[model samples]
Target: MIRRDLLLTLFGIGAGQAILLAVMPFLARAYGPAAFGSYAVIVAVAGIVATIAALRFDLALSGAEDASIVPLSRAGLLLPLLTVPFAIAVLALALRLPFGAHLPFRSDDLSLIGLIALFQGWVLLGSALSTRRGLFATLAAAKIVQPLVFAFTALLLLHDLSLAMAVGWAAAMAATLPAWRHLPSSMGWAETRATMRRLWRFPAISAPMALLDVLALSLPLLVFAGAYGERTAGNYAQVQRLIGAPLVLVATAGGQTFLKHAGDRLRAGVSVLPLIRRFVMVMLALAAVVTVAVALVGQPALTFVVGPGWRTDTGFLLLALLPVLCRVIASPVSHILVLTQRLATQGLWQISYFLATAGVLAIAPRLFGLEGTLGALACSEFLLYGAYLVLAVRAARAANPLPALSSKTRPLSASS
Candidate 1:
């Protein structure tokens, strides 16, 4: 049943992402790279804002039991609900600032980005609630709906790709509220507060980690924008959007299912090492296949989608990034660490990677120029994957004890 749920979820997300990947280059070509870059920056900012609004509640939901659904729902809804106004205020301030005002878009872009953040927060909350309740089908459906709406809307409204993208995401996310309403209710105010207290502990550590991690991924675009201008940033952003398509599909879909199953296994007193190993192996295989395919077809694909003017010799860089994509695919390791109550270790590893990547990026631009940025990214991936692997192993060993030391040890017995 768990395996079926995993496959279904993956299929749904994969279908949605395939549509997104197909439509994005067309959108980029229609709107031009500068507009696409503006879209990327807006989305990046929205992601950061939504993360803040979520306040790590979704992370908490991964380990929550079915009985905790009502409390989790209340807490999840309240946190983002409370944070949205503040997020909007901050966004407003950002728009008024010289930096934000310099964006190659209109004031409506700010409003659209803010709306995206709001919808994203709601999705995080809804998805978390659904996971806690084991509503995998509903969650999968919700995810599927988003990209379908986005793709169709964008295709129909081809003139304004930016507005089309924003509207599509917004409309799809709006559908989730009704879906969430269908979930079984299980608690009231007191239970909500209790759950809130437990979940609140996460953001204290996760917030810093989330911020640092977002900065690490987003800094390259920021740097490109600063050094080369919006046009260059736009080109880089378009390539990144294409490269990220497969990665996000695998990461989000697989990672979501892994968290639920791994958390269940841990709760049932099952050893988590085998699950981690299996996840890593699967991710590595997927990444390898995708990397090779992308290397062979990426240029032609880009040319066909976005026209021949878009110059991004990022195939080598994308190939070098296979490890990072693999690492992202196995992101559930971090979730497992959190589930096992090892937040400090997880936070430590994340911070270390961020700091290391920042240092590398600092020196990279001077060395290999554009390619150097990619090199730095690959280096960061190596550091991150190594750190996570070590920590995940240590965590599994500490959780199970017997498997860590014995060379001939059999797989830990499944408990749940």
Candidate 2:
């Protein structure tokens, strides 16, 4: 079942990656580094907002029962819709702040961030519900539609990268229209309140955990834009996009599958350790293969895809590989924390992750320059995520303790 679900999810991710890879060359040629940099900033801000827009109630939907799913899904949708105006207001005001002058995008792009967040929230809710309901095909379709729409709109709106990205995100949400039909007509205030209370841990714990995780990812882009320049940030962003596509694919497929199966095992009183162990092995093998392949052909491929004069440096790619690989490994089975009700432990880790990311980004650049800073960031994260994997294993064991050995089962002698 896990294999089948993973392949279905991978099918969609594969399609989306193909679309993105096909159009990247055109996008690189048409849009300058400065433009790409600004677009990256827009995405970064929108990503952070979207992470919290639903207060992570969407995650709760994954393990919800049939009768409870509708109300939870409805509440998830409503939260983001309600957040839209607040997001716009806060972002608009932020752009006028003194530090706002250091922001990468112009004032006009602030609204796009809100739009992107709203749409992303919709997609998030849809995906969780779809995964819970075993609608991998629908989930896959949504993935394909997002990149397809983004690619087409991006080509058309070559003049406006931010707007094009927002449009593409909007399309992803639109593709989830079918999924929304599965929601309640309207959750009552009492129902919404009750649901929120019941799932309080998600918003209180999971939301912040998710927000911190995204911020860790987004910090480098924002810092790069402010500290380096748009062109430099753009170059870095492009390298990330290229290297991250496959990671996203593997993470998404593995995560969705694990969420479904692991949740089942936890409910059935089965040990989740075996599943977690399998995922770790798969991710490690994949990371090793990807790192070697990219080392071999990443630079030439980047040059061919995005053209010359745009700093498609292999040094950055190589430095980014280790950290990204660590991330991909942890991300797939990280849900074990949630399934095992280890939110507090997960929260502590995420907080440490965010702080470490900020510190490294702030100080490392000054000491070692861009390449050296990336190397530092990569090494720090390797340790952090390595620790996280250990925690995951412990959490799995704690949640599902091993049975005691029977007296008949004697240990074998070393000589034997």
Candidate 3:
């Protein structure tokens, strides 16, 4: 049953990426690299904002008691929703600044940011709600809906592909149910505030951690583009997408299942260390096989599909192998922090990761150029994820040494 569930989830993710892959040629013909660059920046920014808006409360869903889930999820949304106006003000200011030019925002782009951030927050929370309730199909449906809609809209508005990208993103996200759905949705300010306080580490530590991680990833595109040229940045983004497609195929399914099942075990004070160790072994083995296979086939595959100019730039696929391996292995188990409420440790890791990558970007290029710098960054992440795995194991065990818990009582209906 567990294996079947994992395959189903992977199928959903694979199907969505397949659609995006099929539509890529059409999108590329319609919009130039400059437009895609702009779209990438906007999407990256929206991802950052989504993390802030949802406040990492979703991480707690699987472990949270039923009564706590509704109140906590609702409360998390409050911080972001209340700050929406401020976000808009910042968006407006960012557009006029020279820095925003690289992000290539238009007068209308701020609205897209606003719409995407709002839609993404709810979508994230809704997905979390589904996961916690064991509504796996909803999660599967969500994986499909986003790109299916994105492809349709991209085709329909080829003239305004950038706007279509944002609109498609919002449309797909809006299709997900909110975290508060089926709940009475009547928590008073006092209760909401209380709930927020109870889950304070998520918003306070994890949210910023998420944002910094985003900056670490997204800021590079801008920096790379500035240092080299648009082509370099565009190629890097393309390589990332191609590599990420397969990475996400496994990561998404592994992460959701790990969090749900491992969380259940921990909540009952059961040790998942065996599972974590075995899981890590399997991912590392898979990584070794993938890295070697890609090294052999990557260049030929690129030239055949994307044509000749793409051959030189796809080195990133090989360069990123170590980090991608660490990603798949570490990410599935990182929810240990949520289970342990050890956001401070995770926050520290993020800060170090941000600084290390920034340093690598600044220094490695002078000595070895773009490809070498990317490798340096990947090495740093590889080390960080190692530390993460050790910490996660220790934390999970430390958090679960108490007497075993019995089955929880049924959660009260929404009105309670």
Per-residue lDDT tens digits for candidate 2, residues 31-117, read 978888988898889988998899988887766545567668778878997876687788788788998787776778778888888
Model 3 scores what on Cα lDDT? 0.69
**Candidate 2: regions farther than 4 A off:** 184-186, 400-416
lDDT ranking, best first: 2, 3, 1
What shift in Å separates residue 139 of candidate 3 from its native position after superposition?
A: 0.5
What would the per-residue lDDT of candidate 1 be over residues 1-416, giving only the tens digit for each residue?
Answer: 66787787787777777787777666666678776677677777677777767777666777755545566666667776677678667767776888875544356666766777777777877776666556677677777788777677766755655566567667656656654675557547886777666555567877678777777777777677766777787777766666665576667666777777777776667887888888778777887787787788877776777786676554544734554574675575656666656667777777887787787767787887877677667767876777787777777767732211122323323220
Q: Candidate 1 — worst ten consecutive residues by lDDT sum? A: 401-410
Task: RMSD for all candidates, in order, please.
Answer: 5.8, 6.5, 5.2
TM-score per candidate, in order?
Answer: 0.86, 0.93, 0.87
Give a tens-digit lDDT track for model 3, residues 308-349: 444333367787455667778787787766665566777787
Best by TM-score: 2
- Runs in model 1 deviating more than 4 A are 91-108, 175-187, 312-323, 400-416
At residue 28, give the lDDT of candidate 2: 92
* CA-lDDT, candidates in order: 0.68, 0.81, 0.69
Residue clash pairs of candidate 1: none
